[model samples]
Target: MNSSYANKSIAVLGAGESGEAAARLLHQEKAMVTILDTAEENKLRKKIDALGAEGIRVIADLAAEHESLHGHYDYVILSPGIDPAVPLVQHFIKRRIEMIGELELAFEMCKCPIIGITGTNGKTTTTQLVEKMLNACGVKTVASGNIGPAFSAKVNESSHLDVMTLEVSSFQLESIRRFHCQTSVWLGFAADHLDRYRSMDEYYVAKIRIFENQTEDDWAIVNYRDKLPALKAKKITFSAYVPDGDFSLREGVIHFRGERVLAMSETNLRGSHNAENLMATLGVGFVRGLSFAQMLPPLREYKPLPHRCEILRTVNGAEWVNDSKGTNPDSVEKALHSETRPVVLIAGGKDKGFEYDLLTDLVAARCRSVVVMGEMADRIEAIWKSRLPVANAGRSLEKAVELAHAAAQPGDVVLFSPGTSSFDMFKNYADRGNQFRALVQALPS
Candidate 1:
């Protein structure tokens, strides 16, 4: 009997990257783990074989037997893609079966210090940036949690970094109880994942849990403007304009308040949003005694992560960007505002119940034309029709790219910064970005 699984049978729901990694880890710990998914065995045969080779049980197309399976298993480890309120989950809840996300399980297994990061927009960038700066300063660290490797899979004894910097999503933070971070950074929060939580307050509360287990000695690095997180943790504020905290980009120079450190006027990463991200990472470094001078090289050379303002290529003097990481209205607004030139924007996907009008207002103010795609394109097109030329790609990103590129003029920017998730058309933002780049490269130069 494995005490980690409470000496009871455990089921892992879903077989994506996180689910597979989690199942592997649970099996390594000698837990009686079973992997389940709705897809037919033929489609998931590869994953099933992999799990079977690893001595883990695999089940597929068991929708009819889901209730019975839940009743049998002691706990169900849910993948983030699955909704908490869905009928399958409600059945488990009604049956008194326990459920937790992969992050929760990972937190339980890893003994190293965890630095959890969460926000609507900048979590991935900040997490990677912190990992880079920390590595430069001789800290043994890895960036994992949401978009990359499962922290549980990355855990090893020989690991050099003393701390693990995690880019935790709201979904991952929902079930964490004992996952305490020595340093927690709440970059900023906005209305996101409303579809999952059913309300903004629930979403906010889930993200707020990043600092719930932190002691008074642990620091909560936060945005100066975020009120909810500021009240919860021992606060360390980082801002772009404000000069009071550890780091700020005042006027043009990137300044450090504590040590009077400042970077050169320009950086490799574009936009003031990047400036804010750099500031937050710098603050994290300063508190840890990581020299600002050591981090400056990576800071100067660090490139923006894909689909979040990744400049793909400039053709005919027009810059084409794959900002597919903009999966919400606020992110798209930031992407649009990041540039001065009128943008030929690609925006839409599975709607998360945010106000599309707010996005249209920004597009009207800056976008020259919008190439729409995905399930919610019609609604987005309706909002921006009056202000900008709205062209429908009818849910095809390839067509959307063609339309946007054709509409874009010299000195104009073409950006695929959709204000919604990529599930409607692709696996995630990475797939969307890959497809965009492939199509863009295939285009005649």
Candidate 2:
């Protein structure tokens, strides 16, 4: 047990995966820990019972206990799902109680250097790729943060890791104070999380916090396309369109510092977005003194993760592609551009306060028709009906898939790439994607 945290009172907000992991970690450190969540006690009974067995107090229905929590902690461990603007957070702020995210708390305890990856999209894919590449090159590393298990859960085993590839989200970065990454990769950025943030700038501010504590010895891998502010760390740029960066795609091959590195043909990664992800992964390997030869095995063997432009099945000549991970307009735009065949796109979900008008031109050019669904179906149809054929499937993802399949022709792609969150319908993107795969597989030949 760490003496610094011994007997320290800590409140962990939101008893989700990250919160439970944080509570466990704090308890192991001998802290007086309490887990608070807004969910009903019945819903989280199993989790509560497990934590209670470990001597950690869990208070469900946080709103009812909010008043009782005043002045009860030395610090608060905020889960990523909880908004900072919530009254409980505001109360903690008013009292000057130091609040940090699970990511930050994990960083404080992590013994290994972290390679933090953040972007509006491709975060999970890139994080997985970097972790695979590093481990293949004989570097002991693990991928965590927003991807797999929470960073706090992995901190206990950090001593065994040479480094960690963390998928950092803007939400996790919001409350970070001293969190720093040895190699920070800002893959790319676009408007997202508008519902949680006041404006795009506010969201960008949170995302760029990955570089807040970097020193000269550290590295920042960024896209040349994104205009970033001055940073303390040495910056390495990568791009799929431009050839001027330290790493870039020129012709069909990827070049590093004007030298040939790897050909795009050698890897299974598709799309310009993935090209950027590959380059960023290479940049991390470069910083770690890994040779292109050493990284090629993992890079060559890597395949796209499910739900991100994953081709599910073919009915006649039409391909059913699941891009359910495409949760924002930018991601949908990329999915559209990646397809060579005309797409019958199934889009729309819970609106995140973004305008679908931005995708109008792209949709008109790349899609044969559009099928909208979930809460934003009407709004998406309203935005695209004038420019192209649009059908509203309301709240049924199955209906959206049927509509898309009906609209698809031979040699065309039936793309299910919802441009908003999955909360309005299914449990999450994976659930949405899994159901999509099942639905598409069930379609009559």
Candidate 3:
């Protein structure tokens, strides 16, 4: 247990997974901890009761008791969901209380080296790949942060782990103070979280913070295609479209600085995006003293995670793909380009302030028809209607799947890749994708 936290008062500003984990960790460290959430009491009754059983204070309606919290805490642990611009955060900020994220708090207690992966997309896939590869090569590792479990939840097991493969997000990086990864892999960057960020630049600034504290001993694995800022760590680059980086795709083979690492045919992972993910995974493995031969077994046996261009079934010759993880325009664009057959695309979800017109030309050329759904359906339809046959499914994902099925020819592919978030009509992207899969599976052959 950390002696410094024993007498300090810490307020965790969220009751979600990460927030609860952070509060629990602080309590274990003998800190005076209070967890606060703006959610109604009834909604979080079980969680609140559970935490209270352990003698931890949980404020269910934080907004209602906001004023009472003044001058109480020495530190505030911000959950990824809590916006810094909110009044509660600003209040703590103005008072000069030290604020940190669950990621930072966990980092302070972790004894193992961390391999951090961050980007607009593919962070989850790359994090999983690196974890699996490390474990296969006899390294004790756990996938944490934005992917498996909250960093705080897994920090106690650091002594048992040789490495922690973390999926770092821009939100988690925002409140980090001294958190630094041994190796940081930036998959790629694209415009995302516009609703939370003031601009694309703001989002980029948050992501680049992953490497902010790294020194010459650390490594920064980046995409050769992205125009990123300079970093102090030693850099390694990867590219799927070209053979110019340290790891690159030349013809159909993956190469590491002119040596052939692996061939695409040997792996189950498809799409150029997956190739990029593979290269980044290789870069991480290579830096950790792992050889391509040592990591090949896991790489070949690895199955793609559900909801990222996963094929559900081929019904009556038309392929149904569930890319529910494609929650941004850039991800959807990659999915569209990866398909060979004419696509009957089902897209649109909660608006993140992304411009749909940017995909106008690509949709016109690749899709046989477009089925739009959720909050941004009409807005997306307005952008693509002139370019292709666009059908509005309103807020129903079931209707969207049916429309896309009807529009699909025997040889065509029906792709459900919502180019924005899934908060409008679903719990999350996984919920949205699962519903799409169920709807597709129930269809008559």
Candidate 4:
């Protein structure tokens, strides 16, 4: 939270980008900071070197040998990806070592107002949309948090801004203490991170934590259908269903208090899911004094983010889409339903323990074929095999793309909508998506 950091001995776990940023900022604040990671030193050399250059001690690949050093730190700041359930991390927790994520640390330092967005999906798109709306209205804004630069960089920022639009995740929200946004948006929540959380209830709790430190003066933008418990902040709802909600979409027009704001055709963003995203952004914009005219241009002109059901190009009457950002069952399900053409779904990756049952009916209607690969290929194949024809697209990403392309007819769409993480075969989802883009681009016209 917003506390003095003079001479505070802090241990920043996981020497990744966020860890380095937190360590660097804390060091500037006169906190004695040390870096720690279980990954090999060489793999984390860039961050480790940056911290090392600052005269910070970095203990790489912390094993039993580093156990003795844990007791020296006053607090531990965890990076987003490193779960607190790590046996060593648990050791510190059970003993009452103060643990706060980098978001909480950054909140302590940022002087500007913040708009935080979190959900099961559409978070990045919605965050970008809100930032675009604010910036177009002549308000200084930056998209940070999980999307761009680490939040710690804002601590030393001398520039003035109206607000910072943040894409927060449940992982970052897990350890927040005093992190509160002037306007907080919970786009929607579902069962995700089952791999990290002990139960669905635990994961949902972390997401709702975004509103924890907010006061009654703060605004909470949420889904019209969300059954959230009573909160400290005032609620503003956006609905794709009920037209009576604060921000509603009906008959091709976006309604703010039952008055037409913008038409669905004007905003290039597609799918019912994105309609919900637009409604959330419009809700935040309404509270911030932005009119429909100001938000019109960006919503109309801004293209979809790469790998979020982006159409690469049409080749020989076939369209290949990259929805690599669809790394969950719900997102992939939405992607499949949004496609107008027959779908040859390039799906599966590292398992997140998601239930594919939700996608069953949609794929049965839209997807003609499912090409699967990666760690959870067999499991995913089994899920769709009963509904439609499922083929093992082999282990390589390129092979999977090739297989999907081969299976596609002239009028069909090859959708790379992997419903899980890409770590089993590639560095990350971006890498997987980039390779798919490259391979798709190379296909003969």
Candidate 5:
């Protein structure tokens, strides 16, 4: 426990999952905590009530009457979703008050050596894979950060002796001071989350911050495809497209430093992108002194997580796949590239302002039809209409499935790979994927 935080007056902004977890951890350490969330009380009432019962102040809104409380805060922990550019957060900057993200606080309290993973895509799958390989080799492991329980919640719940494989995001990395990882993995990167970043360079900078505090003893996993800078840690490059690396997946078998590690056919995963994820995780497994046999058991048993090309039961001889997690052009492109069957793609959602022209060529050749929905439905339809039969399903997932089913025939796939965020009609991508599965399962054969 940090004695410095024991009696400090900490103010937590945003009562989201990470925010509430941070507040709870701080409160447990005997800090005088206050939570401020713009969301309505009922939405987060249970968390609010729990904290209020613990004698921590819970304010739904920072009204004028309670505005004075902001200045008295010794430290402000902002959630990942809360933009630092906001006036309220800037106020603390001007006053020289300490402003750090929830992950920053998690770093302060978490004593375990972290295996951190970050990139534009495949962070979740790679993180899950790494955790599996570690545990399969008899190493204690826990996965967190943007995947399951927030880092702070995991910190409060688990012992620090366990190795933590964290799926870090640019938002969480933006405000770190001394958050360091023992081993870092940077998967392939492409244009993503432009809606939150000012420029591509700015986004790239936040992604590279994962390597900021590494030491000579630490391991840095890099992608040979993605250009990166010289770093202090011992760097190990992994790739699926090229063999000039410490680890490379070629001809179904993954080679580590010219030695066989694992075979792609041995695992349940497919696609070139998945091969990249496996190669990256294999690089980390090598550093841990793991063997092909040890990692193979877990890799063989592991299945793709929900919402990323998850195939439902065939109805009427046509396949239905839920890939609602493909919220960017690159991810959706990979999904399209990996599939062999002709697709009736259900695309569009809250657009991140990424260009879709690059994906048009792939869709033109691979997708038989397109069903659009949510915020970017019209824009996506306009861009795709000349290439394929595009139908507008509005913001309804059920309608989207209906249109996709109508367009598909036996041996064709109805792939719900929304190439944007899910904020328009669903709570999140997971909810969108689940709803899509439910609606598609109801479709008749």
Candidate 6:
């Protein structure tokens, strides 16, 4: 695989990180490479210049028409963000051009042992935790894929690393025909990605294909609490309650197969949702032959990721938590259950066809006030307006925070767990969370 396509002509679709990096990698491999993007030529002129200097052709705007681009290239490397239904991409498919994801291209180039992590949630947290645990065990590894650098570029450059830890998204996994991994884990499932996939079954099947390419000799880890994962893998279950094959938090102590691993420690990550994330990380560590002693110590100092129930500051005795990563009803439900105190919930964004009815009941039971924002603010406000005091602050997050803070009592919690995406008001979840943090900090001390 490494040496077979050295001189083959390769066309890269999109000019984002994955596409650009893949084009660079393919060029470096001495493959005739060209990048085609829908981005304006004026906008990507400098990037095109850089690629031109690297001996790769760059076509932008209408100049990147599929017919002209696909006529000459042998293979097409797709950016994960592009929908296959797009006419240009569909044309390539019809022409029978060999299309693969950046991950698949990376797999061909990567020589190290791969450990891929996938789930509905907790992928980013679990990926980082796994990297830290392996590093503590004296293993040289870097976490990449959906969480970090483009996997193709990482494989092209990394020389001395012992392992590659990847957070594989369903979109990236969709085109992977033979992306193999030693250890793969499915955390849990719920309604998600209704916009990209035709049905939930299609979405889940894409995720499970991570294990579909593995052999019997390969290792697969799963959570016992999750029904789909056990059915998909040769199971090794971790729990928050009783001990099983590997790690469990029993009676306030962290243990692996009944051996005490770590004691109760100061980790800012609260709630049972995070507890499940910890269990999944520990399960991966145990499968890789890391000792319970070796794994637990590094994790003791581990910090919870920002925007996932991250505690911002104590404002007038009220605790504000940023959970901008909670982009669906299931995540919001978990965020609400994480605390016992009444919540002033800030939620609303671009709808991805997810139902908000479940959220209304959760808010009634746990939330004191619902502060709605973004484009779908009216829709969210309508659902909970009858049952609770709902405030509509339009599309501004700052105004939403101010309203939530005003509605929150001293002992209550103000949470930003928007049960939808940020595309309506911001670039992405990270940007949305950053703005929320900035607003929170600007409030009175």
Top TM-score model: 3
User: Model 1, which residues run further than 4 Å from truth?
Assistant: 1-8, 66-71, 157-160, 229-232, 241-245, 258-266
lDDT of 6 by residue, 231-274 (tens): 43455677664455365776556666777765555454677667
TM-score against native, each model: 0.92, 0.97, 0.97, 0.95, 0.95, 0.93
Question: Which number leads on lDDT?
Answer: 3
Q: Model 6 compared with the native: what TM-score? A: 0.93
User: Roughly what TM-score does model 3 have, to 2 decimal places?
Assistant: 0.97
In terms of lDDT, the poorest run of 10 residues in model 3 is: 62-71
RMSD of 2: 1.7
How would you encode candidate 5's per-residue C-alpha lDDT over 1-445 as one tens digit per residue?
Answer: 2336888988888878898888888988888888887667777778778878887777785653457455587888988988887765766677787778999888887777899999888999999999988988988888999786899888754464567789999999998889999999999789888888988898999889999999999999989888898888998898877889888877778888888877778778877789889888878887878877777788778999989889887988788888899999888888887789998899999978888888998999999999999989988888989998999988787888888888888999888888889988888999998898888777766
Quality of model 2 by C-alpha lDDT: 0.89
lDDT of 3: 0.90
TM-score of 1: 0.92
lDDT of 1 by residue, 1-445 (tens): 1336534578887787788888888887777888877778899898888889988878887785565464578778888767777766666678787777888777766767878888898988888889888888888888887858877677653255598888888887877767788888878877777677878888888888888888877878888766763344566777764666566766556776655555545467777677778888887887787777787888777777777888888877789988888888888877887889988988888877877876657788898898999999888888889987999999788889889878989999998888888888898778988998899878777
Clashes of 4: 0
Report the lDDT of model 2 for residue 289: 90
**Runs in model 6 with CA error above 4 Å?**
1-3, 63-67, 157-159, 229-233, 241-246, 250-253, 258-260
- Per-residue error for 417 in candidate 3, Å, reads 0.3
Clashing residue pairs in candidate 5, if any?
none
- Could you give the C-alpha RMSD of every candidate to the true structure, in order shown? 2.5, 1.7, 1.5, 1.9, 1.9, 2.2
Give the range of the ten consecutive residues with the poorest summed lDDT in model 4: 153-162
Residue 262, model 3, lDDT: 87
Colliding residue pairs in candidate 6? none
Regions of candidate 2 where Cα sits further than 4 Å from its true position: 1-3, 64-67
Candidate 4, pairs of clashing residues: none
The Cα local distance difference test for each model comes to 0.79, 0.89, 0.90, 0.84, 0.85, 0.82
Local accuracy of candidate 3 as per-residue lDDT tens digits, 275-332: 9999999999888888889998999889989999999999889999999999999999
